[model samples]
Target: MAESIRTGRRKPAGPLAYAALVAASLFAVGPLLWALSTSFKSPDAVLTDTSWIPSAPTLENYTIVLFESQVPRYLFNSVVVAGATVLATLVLATLGAYATARFRFRGRGASLFFILMTSMIPGIAILVPLYFLAVEVGVYDSYLGLIVVYTAWQVPTVLWMLRGFFQTIPTSLEEAGRIDGASDLRVMVQLVLPLAKPGLAAAAVIAFVYVWNDYLIAATMVSSDDKRLVSVGLYNYLSQYGIEWGQLTAAVLVTIVPMVVLFVLMEKRLVAGLSAGATKG
Candidate 1:
């Protein structure tokens, strides 16, 4: 009776709210279901089939994309680029965030403001300068150029997440480490990192997804076929004459699966990180 009264005190979600939620869900999921449906159909059936269920579903599209195309190589390239970006961002952001969280120095506010500003800057504003710099540095069409750009772009996310997490942590832990003769770097790597797992995981996964799915920078910076990231490589199915809808949909589904799996695996930590990062010290 007490629980019922407490529940009753809360405002009831009206029918309009539920309707809007259902509509939004369909808006997001309808395309995904259609893509999944299209991926299973043969080229002829793809056009003819209005129904979601295929008359004869097959793995032929996936098979062709995986075995007969450069898609696997593109996947590997994406992995390398994303991995490199994550590593680079982690290294830079850890030092920057730790310093920002732990120290009070000249221009500290300005520095943080600058970091936030950079994150807000539009990609288009920097694209031309980055492209020219890449060409001049001979990293155009090279993984190094994209890795560098992605690293710079993603560092602010980690900084925001890690700095907030670091602030929430008890400074006594670092003091204890120092008393035991551990250096700042040692305390960070051995002690602090273990506790900041949620933030780190959140940051790394966000970086991975951003780098993996990014098209503008990757497509603009690199023009070579073999060096193409998965997002750019998906365009291989398109021609001036027609679109390979089956292959395109199959590729899209395949590209989405890994990120979904990664998110599911780290969902708890991601939620924790986002919540903690939302609040300032």
Candidate 2:
């Protein structure tokens, strides 16, 4: 009788859940879709075309931005800066996080708490002093200046991330490496790093994205067109007279696609690393 009743009554397909998901997807994707549509539209079509689909698409804007502008140079600058920042962040944060995770030291708790709290501090608070410091160091308006500043700002978050991930690693593995006559560095490089690749990858990606998207710091430090990062370089489309809507939208789409592609590809590792770190933390 129970089996008969179960078979007779079918469950609802949960249209509400599907509807909610669709709404959320639209919310997240709306701006991106708009940028993409604008990127393809002629300048006149952009203001006139109210529909998401472009009524008259053109490639002139993309060509103007991609071929005739300093965008390529800005992209190269961003890559160099972001890459250097990631390497520095990983090396320093790894060492610091491992120390905090494995060693017993005075003020360790306070230090970790302080570092975490600093991450919440507004960038605007430190902007003036940071810019002055960069100029004083003679790295202002240069890749080295941007790289150094980005590394400093991004290190704390990476430190906390690596610390959480390190806590989840069993100490026995390090002990085994030490029993094999390995030094602390050897153990970390040989054993722990391999195990922590997912977390490291996640941290690396996050650091790179932060540097790539960074605007205020880079803008303050770099006034030269040649030194501008892509985030700030987008403003080149705006002159004293007016803004280049079509080219600006094209640049926006170009900027977004690479990061979106990277996230989509590495989302599995990112999610696993973040979720595991959250649990341990």
Candidate 3:
């Protein structure tokens, strides 16, 4: 018993469990692997070759997407919009979350409930209203319109996430800051926020991904080619002529690179933040 405890060993996973895990992973990753394989094949090979490994891989698809298409422009637009949305959402969510977590005020419960309820409403339900409002405000077909809409849609959820994370932090830290003559703003900026880095990282990644992948709002809010986001710009691969599957797959892979890099860099913090937040609320 002492040796078993010292080794900290648990029961090994049965073969069935390993097989189930493998099946689930393959199910999730199969499409992406297919897309990657398709991206490397030539136009003729894309239609004729059904094999996972291409007979002859070519870079023509990547060349068309990178040098000859507007995909680069669209990628730039997505980065700008997603970055702004994440920044604005974090700033607003952090303040709102801290207030809800640390202070008691009139209608606090009702206010939180209302915010959460707004998130439950489908985006499609408000599409028409948002469109007309954007047009009336003279922001249609502009980056500002897209960023504003994305920020508004993301704020409630991010606020809830950060609020739960804030609750997990000890009040003793804030009290100590107060005792040190720090104001609320100073306490938050210098101490609480520093300690909440994992939570902030998690919230920022969520907001960024939401804006990056959104097509409905991007398509409806902006009509100009220059302002189009990656999600909307991918439609260029489809036309009356035909779908350019090789180029389309290449572009798809390109668009996912940023998100992949972000996840790789922030994996540890994101996991820690989510685990901590979930434990408390």
| Residue 21 Cα positional deviation in candidate 2, in Å, after optimal superposition | 1.2
Tell me the tens digit of each residue's lDDT in model 1 across 1-281: 74577577899889999999999999989999999999999999998997999889989999988888777888889999999999999889988999999889999899999999899899999999999999999999999999999999998878877899888888898999999999989998898888877778878888998998788999899998999999888875555217878888888888778778887888877876666564765
Q: Choose 1 or 3, whichever is better by TM-score.
A: 3
TM-score of each: 0.88, 0.90, 0.93
Question: Regarding lDDT, does 1 or 3 come out ahead?
Answer: 3
Query: What ranking of all candidate models by TM-score puts the best one first?
Result: 3, 2, 1
* Candidate 2 local Cα displacement, residue 228, angstroms: 0.6
Per-residue alpha-carbon lDDT of candidate 2 for residues 1-281, written as tens digits (9 for 90 to 100)? 64566456787549898899899999999988888888898888878897888878899989988899887788888888899999999998999999999999999999988888988989999999988898888988888888887888888989988999999989998998899899998898899988889889999999999999888988899989888888888875566227767788888887777778988998887877787674577
Candidate 2 clash pair list: none
Q: Write the per-residue lDDT of candidate 3 for residues 89-129, one digit (tens) a residue.
A: 99999999999999999989999999999999999999999
Q: Which stretch of 10 consecutive residues in model 1 shows the poorest summed lDDT?
A: 235-244
* Poorly placed runs, candidate 3 (over 4 Å): 1-14
Error of 3 at 65 (Å): 0.5
Per-residue lDDT, model 3, residue 108, is: 94
The global Cα lDDT (0 to 1) of model 1 is 0.87
Residue pairs with backbone atoms closer than 3 Å in model 1 (clashes): none
